[model samples]
Target chain A: MAKKKTSLYREFVKGLWDDNPVLRMLLGLCPALAVTNSAINGLAMGMATTFVLLSSSIIISLLRKVIPHQVRIAGYIVIIATFVTVADKFLAAFLPEISKSLGPYVPLIVVNCLILGRQEAFSSKNNVGRSILDALGMGTGFIFVLVVLGGIREILGSATLFNLQILGDWFNPWMIMILPPGAFLTLGILIGLGNWLNERKVKV
Target chain B: MSLLLLFLSAAIVNNFVLTYFLGICPFVGVSKRVSSAVSMGMAVMFVMTITAAVTWLIYHLLLVPFKIEILEYVSFILVIASLVQLVEMFIKKMSKPLYDTLGIYLPLITTNCAILGLALFSVLREYSFIESLVFGIGAGAGFTLALVLMAGIREELELSNVPKPFKGAGITMIVAGSLALAFMGFAGLI
Candidate 1:
């Protein structure tokens, strides 16, 4: 039953595009949907999540040998929560407004399936370098979608992308584009659009 | 009166699933069956109530006093994990039927964001012990109501021919979108 083993580099590279957490796996949509109303907030959340994710991945990868098999998920969660705390405190102290706007979401990252998923799926199996790459890839992939979502919502909702007025006054903002429902509707359409694009690509 | 207002706000005006997008995993996963949804909701409610009290004590008595507010996430998570464990044992020993239905879901609650969100919200709002407890209960009830209703609707949706692409998560999300739209109507209730 000896099959070929893909290199660690491939594992890391795969998460970036081929199996992007948000775009493909749809592992962690809570924060992806919640904080993406504004371009800046989305960016901040993405960076914060990436920091915790990368740090936790490194730690979990390093501790892969010591941690017991049954308790792996619990251990990964503890590690994730610890980094989330660090990130949350840094945001609260350095960027109070963004921290306030994000609110409980920073702490809520502890339960984010993405961090836990990476720890189980990639970090535990790979070396430190590979784990770091995997986390970076997934985090960047996540940020890619976040930036796009934020850009779309911000542009449509405020007639501005990244808070600089893009459209003239003649363009009316779809107030719906910035609220909770907008997050659901936009993501729903995006998923459908994503499937449509994939189907088209398959046809081509 | 203020307590009632808080309950109404958490339960109706600011629903955990509909408004905040918390505990969506089970909301979508276990909500396929009405009975399972009810049981899962009860399990979540039970764990969330305990998480509220425990996280409150941990944050105030330990983290704030020690100026280790940075440890909030770490501590809350540990507390929730242990809380789920304690809940599981208590459920198993207390009632066999309950353990049968809710046993599986209790373990799953450890990762459910709603419980964590409740802890984080109470801490962020600086809710008092009583208010936090009430908030926990209300949020749990709200979660249960949404899950049950969604399960009922999905049961009916099984008969209808939803397009293939929108079958699983796609339809659930669109339904959640409409449910979210419906819940928005409760904004005026506050």
Candidate 2:
């Protein structure tokens, strides 16, 4: 019983860092790259994604047995698309500004490999409790990375963090930092830094 | 002339992979070698073209007429999935060698956001049927261009002494970043 409990805990913890959906696993790169132009957008995108991920995980865990093997992928996608629609409508209705900024990206989340990958790999096999934990862990990890990435870009590009002026008036903002290339460059270096840290820990 | 502008803009000025970040999965996953990258790019282009035509028809003919645009995501995805399966089967039956070359990536196209993004963008822009077809070809060409460029760089990157941690995805991203910057030159043209 203790061993089983520990393994379940391991599953949740792994996603936090070891198998982080973005930095480590590299799933769902599109949203991670596109929406992180500003800290607020990134944070909103992350939470919305978390909501969809959590809800979908719970539902898929319950329906694991019912969905047959042949059409499982399509089944998972339908479930995901339904949640994505809900998320999209919720954002557009309640948070119009964020919705406008996120634009089609919210709907595009339907194709996010992270959520589908989790369904096929973890949620489909695990019980509801474990699947929820895994989803929360992965979602939180995804949110953390997005917030950090957003902060970096915002601070550099606009001399702000979460819409606050962190940098001094004298600080020259790098316009390119908020541009498309900046997302790729910042994420690349971050991934490299992550790899270096992991290697150091392993070596020690 | 308008179609030419659309083609140029979609293909270079605003690349799907670099500018919009639509197809980063295949961009990163299948971009190791130029040959495979070309094959993958071709496969994606073919699918994107068909997806655009079909989705446009469905959206204009069915969804708009019915007033149930809310079903856009669900219906579009289902259409894309079936289309990919159909394309896969058709290819397998028609040409074994081509099917073998595409391998798993053919099926993976169903999940590639580039195709869906193309569909969504075409709808959002209210593109006419001919314009949507042009847009699809342009987007696919852009995706292929980016992928092939990245693959070529990566092929040469094999010899260089990259830092240990930045060996794989990390370095590829930086290369892509620079390529994006270069591609930005086209932004002025359009």
Candidate 3:
């Protein structure tokens, strides 16, 4: 029983770092780059994605047996789209500012390879309990990366964090840190740092 | 002249890949080789043009009229999937050479967010049908341009590298950042 529990724990923990959807696996880079201009935007995008991922994983895992292998991809996409619509509507209704800033990206979640990749990879094969754990782990990792990235960009770009001034009067914002290029540059360096850390761990 | 401006703006001044970050998957995945990148770009351009036209029709004619705009995400995704499938079949049946050239890339286009993003942007902007079509072609062209440029750089990048950890995807991304910065120079064009 202990062994089984530990393995389940490992399943959940791996997604947090080792199999991180953004920094490590490099899945779902579009939104990771698009919406991370502000820390709040990143957090919002992450939460919305997690909602879709968790719901779809549950549904897909529950119906794994019923969904035919030949039509599984289509079925999975439909299920994902349904939940994405819910998340989109929820955001638009309650958080209109974030929704408008996120723009079509809320709807683009339907095609986020991370969510669909999870459905195909972990959820479809695993049981419901494990699928939920996996989704939570991946979602957390995604959110962590987004928050860090957004925080960095927000601070450097605007000298603020979450719209609050982090750097004082003497500090001039980098300006480029919040632009499209900054996103690519920052994410690139972050990925390299992740790889370096992994390499060091393996060696040690 | 306005339509021409839209085309130019979409193609360069407001490139989908660099500016909006729509198609980063293929921008990163298939950009290792210029040849395959060209083919993928062509396939995407073809499908995107068709998708723009079809999705516009479905939105304005079917969904809006029926008050089913809430089904936008679900319906748009389903339409894209089927359109990709149909286009794949039609190509395979009609032209052997063309099909062989674009054989592997067609299916991948279905999940490409750029196509879906184009549809949503057109709808959001309330662009007319012809404008949507022009925007689609232009976006596809911009995507192709970026992919090819990245591939060319990667080809050269293979020969010279400084750090072990920053190789491959890391370097590609930094290069993309530089490219984006350069592309920003075109901001004044429009």
| Candidate maximizing TM-score | 2
Indicate the residue-level lDDT of A135 in model 3.
96
Q: Highest lDDT, which number? A: 2
TM-score, one value per model: 0.91, 0.97, 0.96
Model 2, position A15: C-alpha lDDT score: 87
Candidate 1 deviant stretches above 4 angstroms: A1-9, B89-106
Displacement of residue B2 (Cα, Å) in model 1 is: 2.1
lDDT of 3 by residue, A1-204 (tens): 999999899888988999999988888899999999989999999999999999999999999999999778789989999998899889889999999999999999988989988998889999999999999999999999999999889998999898998799999889999999999999999999999999999999
Worst 10 residues of 3 chain A by lDDT: A70-79
lDDT of 3 by residue, B1-190 (tens): 9999999999999999999999898889889889878878887898899999999999999999999999988888888898888888887888787677655556767779999999999999999999999999999999999999999999999899559999877888899999999999999998
DockQ of each: 0.64, 0.84, 0.81
Tens-digit lDDT track for model 2 on B1-190?
A: 9999999999999999999999898889889889889978987898889888999999999999999899999999998998889888988999788788778777778889898899999999999999999999999999999999999999999999999999998998899899989988778896
Candidate 1, A188: how far from true, in Å? Answer: 1.1
Tell me which of candidates 2 and 3 scores higher on DockQ: 2
For model 3, the stretches where C-alpha displacement exceeds 4 angstroms are: B90-106
Q: Model 3 in CAPRI terms: which quality?
A: high
- Model 2 segments more than 4 A misplaced: B93-103
- DockQ-sorted candidate list, best first: 2, 3, 1
Candidate 2, residue B171: lDDT: 93
